[model samples]
Target: MFRILFFLIIVVSAVEIALFVWLGNVFNVWFVLFGIILTGLLGALLAKQQGLGTMNRARLELSRGRAPAEKILDGLAILIGSVLLFTPGFVTDTIGFLLLIPQTRKPVKLYIKKVLLEKIRNGSIKVFRHY
Candidate 1:
């Protein structure tokens, strides 16, 4: 995981530098800067909206004496999406938007659950959290 993250960082930096140079050549540097700012603002607003909706759903489920596990997953997806959207890139934004949408998030959540269960069943997901 660490190695993958390190590689991703290097790749992302290279891509960002290339994008900056390309955009600088094709359009005003100031416009690219504004675009980055705009995307950040949009991402923040979307995150806030999604977070509140997830919280509300969770609260409603709790009030009905039901487990709100799915709501928690949605909240987590929103957080990840927010982080991705805040990243300056078309690739990140595309991925972030997918995670933010309910239809897309559902499959992603299910996939995550399946992977976690598999790890647990294989005894690879050891309990590390302290109570």
Candidate 2:
């Protein structure tokens, strides 16, 4: 797992660097810098909006004596998306936006839910109910 993570880090860094250089060459350094800043700002704003909404839903679920499983996943996605958006790279920004948008996030959320369920079924993750 560590090896895979290291490899992915190296690959993603190379890709981001190459993209930065290519975009800078095509549209000047300032334009590329401006675009990065703009995206970061926009991403922060969108993440805040989505995060609050998810929090509200979670609160509602808890108030109704229900587990906010889906809302928790949404929060996780938003947190990851926000972090990615804050990272200075177009690739991460694109992925961040995908996770932030509800429509685009649905598939990813479903996949996560499937994985969690599988883990639970296999005893990789144990759930203990207190009540």
Candidate 3:
């Protein structure tokens, strides 16, 4: 796992740099810089909006004495998306947008839930209930 993570970090960094250079050559340095900044600002605004909505939903669920599992997953996706958008790279930004959009985020959240459930069943993750 560590090796895979290290390799991915290196590869992603290289790809980001290559893309930056290519975009700079095709357009201009300032244009590329401006795009990065614009995306970051837009992503931040979107994340804030979605995060607050998710929090409200979670609160509503809690008030009704129901678990806000779905809302929690939505919040997680939004948080990750926001972080990716903050990162300076087109690939990350694309992924970030996917995670931010509710339509796209549903599939991602489902996949996350599936993986967590599998892990718990396989003993890789443990869940304890207070009650």
Ranking by TM-score: 2, 3, 1
- Kindly list the per-residue Cα lDDT of model 3 for residues 25-62, writing each as its tens digit: 99999989998999999999999999999999999999
The stretch of ten residues in a row with the least summed lDDT in candidate 1 is 89-98
Q: Write the per-residue lDDT of candidate 2 for residues 1-131, one digit (tens) a residue.
A: 99999999899999999999999999899998998999999999999999999999999999999989999999999999999999999999999999999999999999999999999999999999988
* Tens digit of per-residue lDDT, candidate 1, span 22-89: 88789988878887788788878888888898999999999999989889889889999999999887
Any idea how many clashes model 2 has?
0
C-alpha lDDT of all candidate models, in order:
0.87, 0.96, 0.95
Once fitted onto the true fold, the runs of candidate 1 whose alpha carbons sit more than 4 angstroms away are 126-131
- C-alpha root-mean-square deviation, each candidate: 3.0, 0.9, 1.0
TM-scores, one per candidate: 0.84, 0.96, 0.95
lDDT of 3 at 49: 94
Error of 2 at 48 (Å): 0.6
Model 2 Cα shift for residue 46 (angstroms): 0.2
Give the lDDT ranking, best first. Answer: 2, 3, 1
